[model samples]
Target: MKKEFAVIGLGRFGGSICRALAEEGMEVMAIDVDEDRVNEFSMIASHAVVGDTTDESVIKSLGIRNFDHVIVAIGDNIQASILTTLILKELGVNKITVKAQNDYHEKVLRKIGADHVVHPERDMGRRIAHNISSNNVLDYLELSDEHSIVEIVANEKLSGHTLIDLDIRAKYGINIVAIKRRNDIIVSPLAHEEIQTNDILIVIGADVDIVRFEKKVMG
Candidate 1:
């Protein structure tokens, strides 16, 4: 059965999530205080309503707790965002994900029983910064403060070398989990498999070790 979702606040983050959920054939109820914002999603979401989520009565009337998931994506309004999340929790919403404005906001959301809190803007900024700094780095995913997984574009220096030949694990303490070559993805690649310059290596390891590997091999 398809899951039902209610996304409160019709800003960029919430709107994008709503559309993506709808595209996956899930039922999405889009809500916002602004009538214009609600009207805009009438065709996109299963139900679009102009209602302030801060009000407990409105929350009950909308039956938000019945949805499989609820997302609070209030824009710039920290008070409203926190209030909405608190009300959702009090109403026994199954799962709640909130978009936090900053570290302080994230802390508050966590305390209020938000199942997940996302700092999308901060994460995107880090990703973009990493991509721009290294010519071979295609993307970066931070697993923790000390570890990360990065997509590195295979350079000529790495080409024609098998995993066994490079011994990346022993030398750099990083593991190449997969290799992406255009349409093909080789997961848990064999040690004997040779790398091509066009391949994108998906590697995971300690941040320092990954940087060492990138600089020593990619350059």
Candidate 2:
């Protein structure tokens, strides 16, 4: 069954999400206050409407509660975004995702019952900075303020060493969650599994510990 999704705001982030969802064969309702933006997406989205999302009556009339997921992507206008989210929650929308401009905005959205909040620009900037800073670090994802999941290349020092021989978990407080060699992947790799020179390790642990592991093991 195709899932139903509503994307509010026609800015870069929201527009990209709406297009991708529609391309994936999902039922998408694209909403925005700008008539031009609505016209731009009318051909791609299942439905497109130019309406003020902050108005509860406008939202209810659109039957937004019928959607399985509603993404509040209002840009610049924090008040409109917060009010729309609050109205959606009150109307019993099944799931609500919101894009927050900053930490303060995220806190407010959380307090108002946003199911998920994303800081796309901040998170993307962090990832780009990490990749540029370290050649060994291929990718980095911040799970929380203290924890992260990282993908690093196995170096000569780690090559041919099994998980038990390295004692990575005990020493660095990080777990080798998965091993990726070329196109192959081994999930929850056993202690006896050997690391190849070019293997990619997907490790999960505290941010500090991940840095420690990267320096000691792959530096």
Among the numbered candidates, top TM-score falls to: 2
Task: List the candidates' TM-scores in order.
Answer: 0.93, 0.97
How good is model 2 by TM-score? 0.97
- Quantify all predictions' global Cα lDDT against the true fold: 0.95, 0.94
Q: What RMSD value applies to candidate 1?
A: 1.6
lDDT of 1 at 88: 95
**Model 1: per-residue lDDT, tens digit, 81-180?**
9999999999999999999999999999999899999888988998899899999898999887689999999989989999999999999999999999
lDDT of 2 by residue, 36-99 (tens): 9999999999999999989999999999999999999999999999999999999999999999
lDDT value, candidate 2, whole model: 0.94
What clash count goes with each model?
0, 0
Off by over 4 Å in 2: none
